[model samples]
Target: MTFAAQVAMFSKLAEEKGMVNSLEGNLSVIDRQTGNIYITPSHRAKCLLTEEEICIVNPQGEQIGGTGKKSSEFFLHEAAYKARPDVGAVVHCHTPYLSAYAFAYRDFETPKDTFLSQIFGNIKCLPYGAHGTHEIHQGIEEALDGRPVALLGGHGVVCVGEDLEDAIGIMEAAENYAKTIAIKHKLF
Candidate 1:
């Protein structure tokens, strides 16, 4: 698939899975040959973004193409790529279950059920940082070590994978398990 098509497909998947709402989430894929990162634009609705709307940015976070601004929270995605060379895609979403944990600065436990447990090992909730700032960049860098998924304190969730499909699937499974746990806690 084309870069924009992959992003649009993943963004739509995230939205359908309840991991994206409004303009609260973004995805990025790195061009291995050119090293340019293509990220979702900041101001568009999750479901409304088109392939041509994706923004290409350099390693230093400078915008090179696409209309409008790159995601203000681009640093989170950038940091993931910088920290893990193996990571080709990053997906960030302000899904409700993850957001609840993010707001509380709580770590996520691997679910007791085998299916759910396999989706997450341990998820760290990084300390709170203001969005689109270096503070957030530092937090993401510190929390992303040795894990494919993490919850950003008071922000949302960030997941890294070999590609967009892997990244989005991990986020979807992780977030759904989180929501299930939340509902279970309410019952018990």
Candidate 2:
């Protein structure tokens, strides 16, 4: 898919899944051919977003193109790319189910459900850090290891993948597992 289309797809996913508020969360993908990153704009409602609003950044985290402002948590995406050279896409979602685990400073215990196990082997929670800061980026990268998904303590969830679809799928899996865990916690 076109880079703009990819950005729009995941941005809509974030909204459709109720993973973000009006201006929350963000998604990004790196164009391997050009080494340029296309990301969602900060403070823009994903459902109403257009392709032109997606921001572009270089490998060095410098904004190189696009008219919209990069997401405020752009550093988080940058850190993921820097730490995992193989990661071509990153998604940060404020999905309530997953954010509950983070807000409670708890790890998302990998669910034993067959589907969850297959999707997220061990999505751990990162140590606490304030949002929009370098510390948050460091904590996320450290917790990420080589995994596709991790939680930002007291903040939200982050997922990295080979592309926008994979990243959004990871986020969806994280939310489902979080839902199962929440149910388990409530009943037991």
Candidate 3:
């Protein structure tokens, strides 16, 4: 599948799974060979995203292809790529369970022996960085130094992987892990 198509497919799946809402999330994958980034558009609903609507930006954040405007949070994705060359895709999700920790400014201190730890390895919540501004994405590289996921302080969650499938897998796993923790605290 094309890179744009892959992003659109995962964006819709993210919406269906409640990892992202109609207009609150973004997904992107880079063409490692060409350095082109296929990303979701700004102000559009992920549930209804189309491959044609996916925007393409060069490594320097210039619009190189596609018809739609790139997401405002593009810096966040750029930072991840710069920090981890091994990552090919990035997903920004506003998932409920995961956002709970972000909103509370708390980190996910998963036990080292747990399955979630294997996936997230203790998610960190970075300090508040206003969305759409450079400040918001600052320190992201350091936070993701050796982790696949991190909670955006007072914002949402960011997950990365070798591709869209891997990125979203980390995202879904993190959400489910967060949900389990919430339920455990409530009932126990």
Best by TM-score: 3
- Per-residue alpha-carbon lDDT of candidate 3 for residues 11-56, written as tens digits (9 for 90 to 100): 8898888777667889999888988889999888888888898999
**Where does candidate 1 stray beyond 4 Å?**
112-115
Better candidate number, 1 or 2, judged by lDDT: 1
lDDT of each: 0.82, 0.81, 0.87
Candidate 2 residue-wise lDDT, 85-126, digit = tens: 888899898788878888887876674657677667777788
For candidate 1, lDDT tens digit of each residue in 46-128? 67777888888987678988775788888888888888888899998888887789889899887566766755667889888
Best by lDDT: 3
Error of 3 at 61 (Å): 1.5
lDDT of 1 at 77: 84
* Candidate 2 wrong stretches, greater than 4 Å: 111-115
**TM-scores for all candidates?**
0.90, 0.90, 0.95
Which residue pairs show backbone clashes in model 2? Answer: none
Summing lDDT over every window of 10 consecutive residues in candidate 2, give the lowest-scoring window. 137-146
Cα RMSD for candidate 1? 1.9
